[model samples]
Target chain A: MNKRVGKQTIETPSKPRIIATASIVGPKEGEGPLKDYFDIILEDDLNGKDTYEKAESSMMYTAVNEVIKKANFKEENIDYLLAGDLLNQLTSACFAAKDMDIPFIGLFGACSTMTESLAMGSLMIDGGYANHVIAATSSHFSSAERQFRFPLEYGSQRPPTAQWTVTGSGAMLLGREGNFPYISYVTMGKVKDYGVNDVNNMGEAMAPAAVDTIAQHLRDTGRTPDYYDIIATGDLGKVGKRITKELLLEHGFELKDNYIDCGDEIFEHERQKTNSGGSGCGCSAVVDCGYIYKNMLNGKFKRVLLVSTGALLSSTSCFQGLNIPGIAHAVAVEI
Target chain B: MNKRVGKQTIETPSKPRIIATASIVGPKEGEGPLKDYFDIILEDDLNGKDTYEKAESSMMYTAVNEVIKKANFKEENIDYLLAGDLLNQLTSACFAAKDMDIPFIGLFGACSTMTESLAMGSLMIDGGYANHVIAATSSHFSSAERQFRFPLEYGSQRPPTAQWTVTGSGAMLLGREGNFPYISYVTMGKVKDYGVNDVNNMGEAMAPAAVDTIAQHLRDTGRTPDYYDIIATGDLGKVGKRITKELLLEHGFELKDNYIDCGDEIFEHERQKTNSGGSGCGCSAVVDCGYIYKNMLNGKFKRVLLVSTGALLSSTSCFQGLNIPGIAHAVAVEI
Candidate 1:
């Protein structure tokens, strides 16, 4: 029986010209979760909307404003503002854009926001619409804790497979032409329901979803993992990593050497105690903007596939008895 | 010094594909603010969020779930969940996507979210990264009011330039070869900062930003508004609309016949007591998915530019005495 691969083709005469890409983090990289690149800090205060809202808004607001300030390109050059955050309304990014003298368009892609925004921004550029696009997102412990998990002072112990949200902000400049990567290729993962049926252990829940998308990407592009200097998934913790490796090998493909997960690389130190890695829109973003982009500039990696992953689940859904489904999009960053 | 325009080129061996797009609303035709689409029985208790926390999330949850249900695309087939909303952290979109069991990528484009999502989803499809992508955003009167204006029950009269947030949802199936009009082109508006120093009136504040981008699009694509059956901008209200018209004429281009603004179209009947036109991410979205799309399919229109407008601003910024800026993105829907 011949099964359909579920593919469709259309002629889209669009070329998104990336104007630029930028990023910001707390004072220290991985030293403090909340200190990645935030200009404003919450001193362990777990205030409800009172503190969390401002902190979240402030960090994203700062990063976006800074990127705009540093662009050298007039704010008038920016055609649309595409931004997202780990928080609810994407308030920080949205509000920050709102406060600016320039107008905007916002987005939400969890830790993969920058990529999402860039993907869209590139569309506008490719389609011969606008010349400049700004994509941004932020993550904060104080803000994310209250929204995604517990309050800041809740002191919830994370499982070894658990990941940390980076206290950082990433912004990219995509113009008709600039130093930014031209979004060489993009591959989206099908939403996969691994049916792990374990919310408490996200690794088991999301690992298969990650593997399926990664494997599909290789198949679709007809390129081996060896083609990329780094084949990075957005965030898959320790257990997910174990499973991803195993699944890749089972499929007659091996990527033990150059395949790196953003979470694992960002929080590799014992001090972080993040046995799995760092997760969140900021996690993969910081690595992408701060680490990966820099590495590409230095010619350390020639071709890279950035696979940002997101888990679809909410507190209510968890309460309503739902399994975690995961999806990923792969962006090929080439020299 | 010579200012040179740069080029961001997209080179691919093959054409990229689209996965899907979805939309929901109250009425199918003729815009009339919130009353048209949603089965909105104006209740004194009608609120966007139950509390400040729930305001954004609940609205996003409603739209996301509605799209998921309507699309009938199983969550497992959805590789990437792209969403954005007006709340901080993109709470509603994020929270909504979190529960659906698909990996999520959040977005924030203030009012231009729906178009922004489409652009990104199209890129993922074109890039052949993922098989499917979901893009959505929502705004509730109660939710946005509390965050950006007075409380949900604020009896204060709205300003003429204050457009109502459509209490509805929209989604689309943007597959590579779907029957729906392909998101063939996307023209980004230049981030123009004409420095409109108005906070209370978004229409006037956003007019220049709209004109700047729209005019540039004509130049970039070298197509007159006559090239499209319908040339529409999202929510530029009555005041901004006239100026946009004037600006176009000044640029030797006029979209007199098929030109329309989502704000003017949605608030046509509400003129007696309207401040601005309709606002929020769903304004253009509801129109696109509901009226524009259907009209295009029915032969009332052929090539249409769904220009979604956005005012990037926040309550905090307004409180801090900052001016309101605007933006718009044009999505070409071809039959």
Candidate 2:
């Protein structure tokens, strides 16, 4: 039975295993530092699709198929597909689910969707509700830019605080038991808003949420930062990562050298000209499913904590001058 | 233990109970047939908020607070808040969560979100991950119109098949044990597309998915349609409800007089001047939480199957000339 550990954390005694994983990225992300980690790197962002939205859906579909294939499981073997993406009404996930033919549970947590799906999937497995489930998410640079920011054709100059949206998709298959790394605990997060209104500075907006969830996770699990080999925050970039470190310090928890941000690690920031670094639903997804999963299997990391952060704002909300509220969900995985 | 009954259904033996429910509606909905069943009815749709989006968020916030209050539980006593709405990036749900201070899991199934949240919340309670959870959803006609269709200011011509978006909010509090109606089973849905491209005719688009889930649920649980006192679909409006009846007949499961559509029951069609009927996330939400919950408590309904249907389409996808896909999640409740 799954145990409610503390205020926010749930301890999954059954330890749902990550049976298989796959990641696919666009041309720009392929040129980044984690290039060798991804399973497939597209030559172009559009991938022969007429629209960027279709391209995003195609990438997610490919990743789902790849993960199932890696697990040697037929499509019917999967019990559920929990997926979300940074799209209006989750268009990409819905389109991908249409092709997959699995029982679908649609989610929307902005960029935090990866860990959100992971936490829910783990709960379903640990509770004996399902034997196999897939968690997946995707985001496209061009599609996000047009929806959230200026259109690419306008050549709008972005501020230094702006982060580049990652064009990629990642899929992870979880099972009741396996030799692979297992999900041990999950920490659900509350929305945290520090009244940050700048749309370009999502890092600043989401940092408080990252700090809240991470600190709450540590407190609930009764573990220090040193307990894990690595504590990774999803897509906080340089600016948000620094803010998280400072805020977490104020919360009486000091994140040391073991801490990392997927946004900061995914790209060669200065060389790649990714101003603040990579950010999107795809940022943490690709990094965790590709680089982190591979390293965990290789025995390079025994235990890891992944906190995927999301800035809950829309173009409409931003235009209405509403404050951007941030949220983060943390999942602990161990080998 | 939760048992996977068949392909899509899960038998929740623990039977998570609906401890309390609250429904709030706008002026138009307040004038509807089920108006007296709602907890609160606003004189105006805006509810004094400047923007329609904020008004929608405010309604959801009120519904959450009202539900908790009705249950005699404090905000902190609620373990999780699962919510979604019809907006870009789920603006209403995020903003509502920001004010609630509870662990939030954002979901997006378009109008089907009410049942989706309920299914997830019930699973959480039955799975031992949470003791008490709130499942909620909201939709405002003006906000949805501006987001999905033309703005109200445009005075766009509507087809006879077009359904009027409902302006309301509903919230249900689910606990591990209680004397109230309990969720006995849940059937997760898959995306179903019949190549329906007409944006105005959403009812026809979603009927196939509704029929698919209802039939699958009955087959998985080894029950006939007569097992439920009432089997309700979320927002199939007039057009979709007829289509659903015909399709289910073809599937060898005849939906008799016990079948109802929340959208169809919401308003007095021709008198209300609602083209097809009322529709939105709030349509099924208010009907179920208000009319259905109250009736169940009064021994009017011993069993109910709510299959919330959603058209998984965005304005972007519609503009791209893509076909609209549909999904429906069914939660069986019994006293």
Candidate 3:
């Protein structure tokens, strides 16, 4: 019954199913290609909230509640709620959880939080620690902009390498029994830094970590790239996606057309005026929970590998002239 | 085999042992009551680092290395490194993990991180996800002061209700086998907000959460206050500790002299001029890793409950007029 595989990947023989999923997005994301897949779309980014932080929390709360409702389960049915966000101190996730009565564990993996929570939730179900668990995360463009870079009011000019932060939230409920796509393996990532210090270039900072985890997962499971219908990375936008493909090829893994980056898929780059692509915890979260999950149910994808990447940097760390450290966690789902 | 008890408590029947522990503290903490119990005490808080943030990361790195050394295990032997801190984006943990090759999972429970990490680590071992895992956390007074409150150079006067942020790091290694105290159960806490808005009074903000988790653990396990040799609340200080006692009493649980707060135990209140007491992620972490773990091995205590409380607030949230939300996670250790 030992679930650990090789060095870092964990095999979930019990195959905890993704019983329910919900995604909520702002107006901009609602106009994206995956618009029809989302559960809720806000007319305004603030959603009548006073601040962007509160809006982010509201989005996450809606996603969590919607997911539970979708599963036909009350709040009390959930044994544990594992959540995180990009905000400092995880304000969004914590505030969202405050309204719920479930036991909570807050996580911080930057953008990788989507997979981090999913992996932990799966482990809880596979390990017999709980029957139902909710894994969730959120990110808001205005909130992240003010915290990490320039405020939206400042109207700072973005470089070509800069990516748009998605204003959205995603929640997935994992249960002991379901006929949906189930989590079969999880590859925990290591902190990987390649001395990338440009705050504007998150893609470059996070690419190596994505490649590292993806390669590790394939190696640990002894599976070829063809084993998965699609290999998706969390938020490594255009620049990082290209780097990830090259680096993965160097690792003897050919990431062909089957490979995609959530950041790259989240928005219409040119039409949306997103320089690189959509980037944030929400980018991958909404993509996976909406498009990916729905497609799997429709028999489009039999197997999928989700590698959520995160750049572990803060304004303080950047001010201190430290390089950004990146991390990526992978969760394998199969029908 | 379900392991989950009544509502929130998850029993670890496999009993993952605390095989190794190490604590490193700043000069101020080295002068405290449990100074002799720590593995390493620094003469300077900065430890030759340019910034206090780096100092915190270095201390945590030292603690992780020391614990691994104490356990006679190589870096590869440890399956996972679960760590967090009070810093934004968990910079200290990420930088520390950057040096080590272990798979990392970043967590953010504010000060409750120690027990949060411990709970997750215990679950990992109990669930057969990994053979070994490390739970660690750190905080630095200078770094936290500037980030959460005023800059140290501001020489801002602290009120009696304000607790001192501890400058230290603590790491513990949990494994499948050992002749030491093992984690028996973990009671996950819910985010509880009581409309306490004072930024300086963390104890008052976190007290209700501490009480809730403690009472829930007792109710779920069908245990009385006397079931534990000592019940410790992490960094609740004097004000919060008193509130916790009163609240628990209202819940029909009378915590007698067996109750202790890590915040109160760390520093000599009057002598150290730490108005309320030491309060930070390091407060409970260093105490448990240095004093409690060592004492347990020496048969000085039989069963202990470590409840680490956290006030989830940031400068942004506080500025936005949001109330501080508190959370507490408990891990029961028995010899």
Alpha-carbon shift of residue B159 in model 3 (angstroms)? 1.2
Per-residue CA lDDT of model 3 for A1-335, tens digit only, reads: 58888789999998999998999999999998889999999999999999999999999999999999999999999998999999999999999999999989999999999999999999999888899999999999999999999867889999999999999999999997869899999999999999999999999999999999999999999999999999999888899999999999999999988999888988898999988998899999999999999999999999999999999999999999999989999999999
RMSD of 3: 0.7
Q: lDDT for every model?
A: 0.61, 0.94, 0.94
DockQ per candidate: 0.18, 0.81, 0.88
Residue-wise C-alpha lDDT for candidate 2, range A8-78, written one tens digit per residue: 99989889999999999999999999999999999989989999999999999999999999999999999
**Docking quality tier of candidate 3?**
high
Model 1 agreement with the true structure over B202-235: per-residue lDDT tens digits: 7777677677766766675667888888987877
What's the fnat for candidate 3, on a 0 to 1 scale?
0.87
The whole-model C-alpha lDDT of candidate 3 against the native structure comes to: 0.94
Error of 2 at B239 (Å): 0.9
Sort every candidate by DockQ, greatest first: 3, 2, 1
Task: Write the number of the candidate with greater lDDT, choosing between 1 and 3.
Answer: 3
| Residue B120's lDDT in candidate 3 | 99
Q: Candidate 2 — which residues are off by over 4 angstroms?
A: none
Question: Ten residues in a row with the worst lDDT in model 3 chain A?
Answer: A1-10
Residue A180, model 3, lDDT: 88
